[model samples]
Target: MTEFIPPGTCFLDLPSPFPMKRGGALHGARVAYETWGVLNASRDNAILIVTGLSPDAHAASNAGNREPGWWEPMLGPGKPIDSDRWFVICVNSLGSCKGSTGPASINPQTGHLYRLDFPDLSVEDGADAAAHVVRELGIERLACIIGNSMGGMTALAFLLRHPGLARSHINISGAARALPFSIAIRSLQREAIRLDPNWNHGQYDDERYPESGMRMARKLGVITYRSALEWDGRFGRVRLDSDRAEDDPFGLEFEVESYLEGHARRFVRRYDPNCYLYLSRSMDWFDVGEYCADRAGNPGDTDTRAGLAAIHVEKALAIGVQTDILFPLQQQEEIADGLRAGGAQSEFLPLPSPQGHDAFLVDIARFGPAVAGFLERL
Candidate 1:
């Protein structure tokens, strides 16, 4: 499985023998990243954007690649991210197949694909990789670090691991830790992939790819990415054509089912199942509470709260959609409350968005002003 390197994506060679958070190391590895705007003379205007699972480094259009990015609506000149005012850098997560070294990447020593042989990945490892990218670019500290969904977890780890490196943060639809429900959902997704006979223990090729497993996994994910409200509103219980339904009594009965099937099919071949497995498992293994074992001052505090309080950003904003089942609203509230306890000016905003965890990417009209106002005040 070849990694998907986006056009115009930039690469940063990681330090040789780059140690993984768990055991094992990569002799030669690289991170994929893309930047918008320019760092000012003072270099205090640099901002970093870490992504959720599956997103590439391209966050928006640039001279090198005119194609609009996944977050094209939110980032650009005068947009919410306001590239003209700040130098924005978005990095593909380290364990991702999007131009970053991951399971899909070839092993340097063996000259064979890493596949399942890749070292165990942790959210902290991604944080460390992102930090290296910023430092390599000559930015001593970032104005802000923005994260979405899994990237939210990475951002939290980034802050805790490297205190004072980013002055502020905007955590959108992110969480301090993976909730049990999220873990359960991801477990099912992974199970779907592994159970596919075509997976072949992560050794399948194009001719024998795990399409069924990948489709099931992606469909399950897509079902969770948005809310039931959005589903009902977008595609009620509308049935497909009677002729089509008659052809296969058990297949694609409703509009929603068709939507999911179409979406899953589109994604199955675009992303490597092995990479998906690695990234999904990493989220399950991450727990911010692990860092709070020794913090004694906050009596009766949960580890999640105590750990979040240990971080020291000067200012922060944690946003969550009201309908987000994955990465619920409470997590964002906890982030704000905990950051406030640590003396950062923090606030949590819960929007009445029906898009669920993916609302930050859509519903820009509602999210745009909130982000712009925060950045403007900075």
Candidate 2:
């Protein structure tokens, strides 16, 4: 079992309505999150960083006796998320396995891991849980809510679902809806895990986990999370090794294979395949329009511009990387345009980087300042 205790943090046992999206009922659910800095008496300094899929709430700090966090370069005492100037909190998403309610959580009815028994999750529900966390922190309003990828989707959900929750919003490389092409690709990844024999229909015990299936899923995800240009430049179609192979495909067939192997190994070890499947599925089903309704309730509320104008946020920032094909620059532009059309104070910048969708992590020099500059202005 994964240990629940992380150093210097507290777990908040949050309650959820049983059966969530569809199952039956969960007696209770817990959300494991960590906070840095301190909330002033007025509680106006809180900044929430909702993580992307598959990552836990350990956003900054060396908590959980875990390795340096995924975004440590940009979140520290003097970094972009500056613990010194603002109170920062990161929470595991509602459907995540890391001390949050998900497929791995115990099902009160069956008394086993939810697995396939878990109710389906939606992006709006995920965002609602996040809003609950912020409220639990006694933050009536937020300085900003920042998110990336699926986290960005959740951030949008928060704004759409709760019109005035935050004074500012920052969505990086995300869209209002999942593109059909993206859904098609993610479906293949889920299939890779489901087809694995060792998956045992999500009933496999601890000792008999589906490592190979999980690895395949990670390999497939790595392909979509980044750009083809990145792959070509980083790993051209080179030989397996320095020496020629005697018709041997046993070793690294290309630099891309080696790159994928390292990525696959790490992801499989750190993540749960069931969590991967469920979260990816939730992302595929994500659409802001799903929550909005027309007079007939047939689901065609495409004009987010009016909603943006109605929001009472004081300031906001929207950013995108030039090479982020997964959520291309146009999406960020749309968000910025909507905010401006709504008369909200927001700025949009598209950073030029070769790291593609991963630029938010690798292109720190550019992003670091952008983040800092935005927060500083606020």
On TM-score, the candidate that comes out on top is 1
Candidate 1 Cα misplacement greater than 4 A, ranges: 245-247, 294-302
Model 1 TM-score on a 0 to 1 scale: 0.97
Candidate 1 least-lDDT 10 residues: 293-302
Which parts of model 2 are misplaced by more than 4 Å?
1-9, 16-25, 62-67, 236-251, 294-296, 300-312
In candidate 1 the C-alpha lDDT for residue 134 amounts to 95
Task: Provide the overall lDDT of each model, using Cα atoms, as 2-decimal numbers.
Answer: 0.91, 0.76
Residue-level lDDT of model 2, residues 127-169, one tens digit each, is 7777878898899887888988889888887887777778888
> For model 1, what is the C-alpha lDDT against the true structure?
0.91
Model 2 residue pairs with clashes: 18-25, 18-26, 19-25, 309-342
RMSD of each: 2.1, 2.6
